[model samples]
Target: MTEAAGKSYDGLPGAFRFAFSRSNSWLFKLYVAVALVLAGLVTIIFVFALIVLIADTVDASDGSISLLRSFFVLVGLLVVLPILAPVLFVARRHRREIGDDTGYDRRLASTGFLFIFAVYLGLVVSTPPEQQTSVDGALGPVLEVLYGLPSIVGLVPPVVAVLVIYGTHRLSR
Candidate 1:
């Protein structure tokens, strides 16, 4: 049997080499870092909002609060806290690897933006309509603002991702 040799791109054109080197630059890494951070923050915020919604639902139920409900909430936190953090971390790391190898920052940015948008959309769709109604006093607007925020804020993550990518590209050169 013949031994296999490692693959080489040594004979590739200068443009291909330059493209590969540029993708591996510190600037590209910075872009990936910022994208990952923004994606993480958006995910965390959405999860927190979801937790709060669940807690509020339990508290507002007409029946006496039961240990079962509290237990479920606790279980939810236990499951989600551990699972989500690492998943986000691993996902970001994977994205970094893809970006580094392929120079696919725009595609990564788009995917991250879509993920953030979907989370916000889910939050908005799941929220109770009653929660959106106006109330008297200073708390009314605040509650409304809080509940209405997901829809309004959904546009932000993608925009920020694009800006970060663009800014890093410009700064790197």
Candidate 2:
């Protein structure tokens, strides 16, 4: 039988793994399942709030799609993934330790920061025409630095999560 049928998230702390534990108690498992669904609902609500916040903060002059506005919204949306990544990564790693290889962890590790970099790189290519022409001046450098700062900052959390997860995994081994 599979581990989930009888095993639990052995290496994880009780607090960390409570929702993910594969305990034998049917009621506990059902409660966890319901909690997960509720968590998903909360995340959906968060995304909607983020969308509204971004839309309000970014001024799209004449109701046209400004590259700067798009950048803000995309970065906001991108943040949602990393927010949940570490918890999910830890749970999966602990589950694997207990002999439950669901095959999702491999995909998660392989993708890593590729998605974040890809989207950020795409945004980098969309430099506002006004900014492009000022490339030779002093303000140009400052503007470019300011423009790229958000994407650079956005990369930190996911990269840190990956490093922390790898470090912990290595130590566990």
Candidate 3:
């Protein structure tokens, strides 16, 4: 098989290669990576602000200027649009190329698993002990380990849903 074909095997490295193949320059890849991170952070902030605003509205907070400030932050998320467009364009092109690769499914499965595992590990480790679940079970030490899992484990299914959407980008065609 060609080197490119060999790179399409079932793994995160392969997925990285496949996703980044369109751009040969490391600099450009770094640029895209930074842009994606920034966009993701801004989107997260916008969502947080929206949730806070919603909570305030539900509470019927005394008429104040703070609500207007939160609305402005929500609107400010639009400033990231210029950075988002080209990043999306690159992703769309990569999605289109998935059809040409015989190993796409395998790569997607493996990469999705690894990504989820890594993210969960990070979340669990970073979460404070107070935030984790505690359960008494029959497994002794094994149960001790399991009991330390955070409530954020509830987020795994949604994360998997996102991975499905990302990995099956070609479905949009």
Candidate 4:
């Protein structure tokens, strides 16, 4: 009977408890599952990037900027699923397993980040590399900024998602 009350006594938000709680009150295994997912997502991203690099080298496009923009598009799409699903599933399963409130409110948090990532990627893809920035970015420094920006900012979303969900999960335990 690993219902909400059965599984958790802290009376935290349903989404928090749901995501970190284990099946049949198996907190330890739930932690392990989260760890595995984190590990797998990293590997998946690494392999995908390697493939993209290989593809680019084989058919070097004159429009490297366009290809780089497409890379950001791919990165966002890749990150969204891994960042979102398991956490939401945890919240959802709680409703069925333990009669929790279904955490619709908390589950919607995923959409916010998703939309942000989509917008950021769209900007990266649409704006020409030289004009992507706002601070008079047509010069060489602008090109340097554009080249560096994606790799730097591109990494933040996944790391933030991991930190947030992992923090919540571990704190629950």
- In the range 40-108, model 3's lDDT, one tens digit per residue, is 786787777767766767766665656676666745454344334333434444544534432443334
Put down candidate 1 lDDT per residue, 102-167, tens digits, no spaces: 334344433444444544454553466665566799977755665666554644544454455345
Candidate 2, superposed: residue stretches over 4 Å from native = 1-19, 22-70, 94-162, 170-173
User: How many pairs of residues collide in each model?
Assistant: 0, 0, 0, 0
Q: Tens-digit lDDT track for model 2 on 1-173?
A: 45663364444244236434533334434434443454466457767866786677566455454564566556555544443443356455555555444333333333333434433444554555455444666777765664555544544545555465456445543
lDDT (Cα atoms) of all candidates against the true structure: 0.44, 0.48, 0.50, 0.50
- Candidate 3: which pairs clash? none
Candidate 4 lDDT over 75-154, as tens digits, reads 65565544444445455555445334334324333433443454455445445565655455456564455455655565
Q: In model 3, which range of ten residues has the least summed lDDT? A: 101-110
Which candidate has the top score in TM-score? 3
lDDT of 1: 0.44
* Cα error, candidate 3, residue 140 (Å): 62
TM for every model, in the order presented, reads 0.30, 0.32, 0.35, 0.34
| Candidate scoring better on TM-score of 1 and 2 | 2
Distance (Å) between predicted and true CA of 152, model 1? 21
Q: Tell me which residue pairs clash in candidate 1.
A: none
Candidate 4 off by > 4 Å: 1-77, 99-128, 131-150, 170-173
